[model samples]
Target: MKKKCISGLVMLLCVMLVSTSVLFAAGSKESGASNEVDKIKSRGVLNVGVKVDVPGFGYKDISTGANVGFETDLARQIAKVILGDASKVSFTPVTAKTRGPLLDTGELDIVIATFTVTEERKLSYEFSTIYYTDAVSLLVKKSGGYKSLKDLDGKTIGVAQSATTKAVLETEAKNQGITLKFSEYASYPELKVALDSGRIDSFSVDRAILMGYVEDSSEILPDKYSPQEYGAAMKKGNLALLSVVNSTIADLDASGELLAMKAKWGLDK
Candidate 1:
């Protein structure tokens, strides 16, 4: 009888021990789990990807050595909304090809780098509503006598990799009965160099981006096509952060601050 009692007590203790361990394990997991917004808040600084080369949108100001532009300002606004301080944000310069991979690696919390929203991209990442609209345009040297895209038939045009310009222009070329050859560059500065060195007859990308590279020697051809809508992007399943971003953009637009910011950077045109 005593042995039976002892065995029963041992079983009860074992059950209690197992229950305690299960509770402890669950508690550890619950304590460790945090959503996207909580992670950003815990860090106290928002990390964003931006373009360092495109002026009026994102660029490094030489005198200040600070990034300044419409999109940079947007990042600050987003940081302020999320972290309660505008200055508590960091920028990682990203190009067309690097932005997606950076965002995929969890190195960046968000991308404010003139990311164009497309049906194809929505499959990979979550994007905010369109914050800015622009059209793909061309920049050609005046000496080339290239009056329009149609004039550049059989001529090679420079385009940025991972941008929609090349595809849109190809369709336009087909419609206009002109065949265009394209040379892809990783950056706008490189494309400009290609144009300057006679390797490419024209530089083509979003007009807002092209504006920064235009010079006394080159002019943006009066051709614009395929409206591109810019949106901020984050990895899929970051709905907590995406909700905040989308709401912040809506508030900015509703308050007319978005337009004012655009005008401040001469982007309202």
Candidate 2:
């Protein structure tokens, strides 16, 4: 009877051990999730992806080497609201081809470059409500006498390869029954050079970008171009992040910060 009692006690201890292990495992998972939440709350830093080249929309100032433009300013503002330190932002230069992949890989917390919102893009990413509005516009040398998109027919137009501009132009051309020779450049700077040297008669982008470039460069403005607005892009299912972004943007717009930013950036007519 003593031996039997010993065996029963041993079994009870084994059961208790297994039960305790299971409880600990469940607790660990909850703890991990809680830790993730805590990390975000504590870190207070936002990793942002922005274009290092697109002037007035996203670009590094040549003199200051500081990131400036509408998107850059907006990114700083969003970071201020979310992280409480606009200066706590880490900006990574993202090109059109790499922005999506970088965001998907979790390398970027947000992308605030001049990314356009589209239904197809929505499948992979979310977009805040239209933060800025824009229509396609042109950049022409003062001596070129080109005033609008209509002036580019049959002319070699410089465009950043793999951009929305080419398609927008093609669609507009088709609708207007016109033809244009497209000269593709790998980057915006190259396209700008091509336009200045007369290798292409015009360069196109959202009007705001064109105007910003013109405002800063005598080689490029009033006689050179015009602008429009574009929306902010974010990752899909990142509803928490998107919510914060939308709120910040709405606040900026309602308070006139958005309009004021554009005006300060030379996008004002």
Candidate 3:
């Protein structure tokens, strides 16, 4: 009888150990599956990286002192989806040079700052469905009389550093057999200043961003050198988070909210 009791206790201990192992495995799977989305929901705030200077896309309005633009609208919509309130968002101003690194290090939950999706960028980060499409264009002083890309041959173009604009422009120039000079700035505001001050003959970037800065004295050239598709960016392998963003985009598209946003921001189509 003593031997039988001992054997029963040993079996009970084994069962308990197996049960604990299964529970731990289940808990880990749940945690891993919902890591990013669960964290954001728990925080009650969605942290978005956006541009404060680029007009119509993601600009901080001076009168209201609030971030306002097409991308801003999308970010707020995302906040509404994730947190059940559109106001629960913190917009972190990020430039072309900093946006990717910030997203990589978890400083930003999403980047909607006119982020262009490209094969090269895809290696480092994943992007949601294309939310908006833009084209690379030239913004020149009205007096410059630059009517065509060929006319700008040998002229200096100001572009945002670390942006795809530079590469796109270079490729276009080479394909057209036009020799050009490029001056790189860290931000769109700097490029605007350079173009305004006559330091650079033209400012090259996405037409969506250039439209925000165009004044009566400046005009965008008619030619679109390259096409750009803007998408929301996040760290790679976050399919849960990516799915959420994609669904938000799809909802916006289906509800015509995306087109409404573009109209509000003066984006063409």
Q: Give the alpha-carbon lDDT of every model.
A: 0.92, 0.74, 0.90
**Model 1 alpha-carbon miss at residue 234, Å:** 0.5
Off by over 4 Å in 1: 1-34
Which residue pairs show collisions in model 1? none
| lDDT, model 3, position 15 | 100
RMSD (Cα, Å) of model 1: 6.5
TM-scores, all models, native as reference: 0.87, 0.75, 0.88
Give the clashing residue pairs of candidate 2, or none.
133-229, 134-228, 134-229, 207-227, 207-228, 208-227, 208-228, 214-221
* Every model: Cα RMSD to truth: 6.5, 8.2, 5.6
State the lDDT of candidate 2 residue by residue for 1-269, as single tens digits. 99999999999999999999999988886676445334545876777899888766788878998888778899899888866778878888887777888888878878887787766788888788877666667787767766666666798877766667777778778877889888888777777777767788887776665655563332332222223335666655666667778899899888988989978776555
Off by over 4 Å in 2: 1-43, 215-229
Deviating ranges (above 4 Å) for candidate 3: 1-33
Best by TM-score: 3
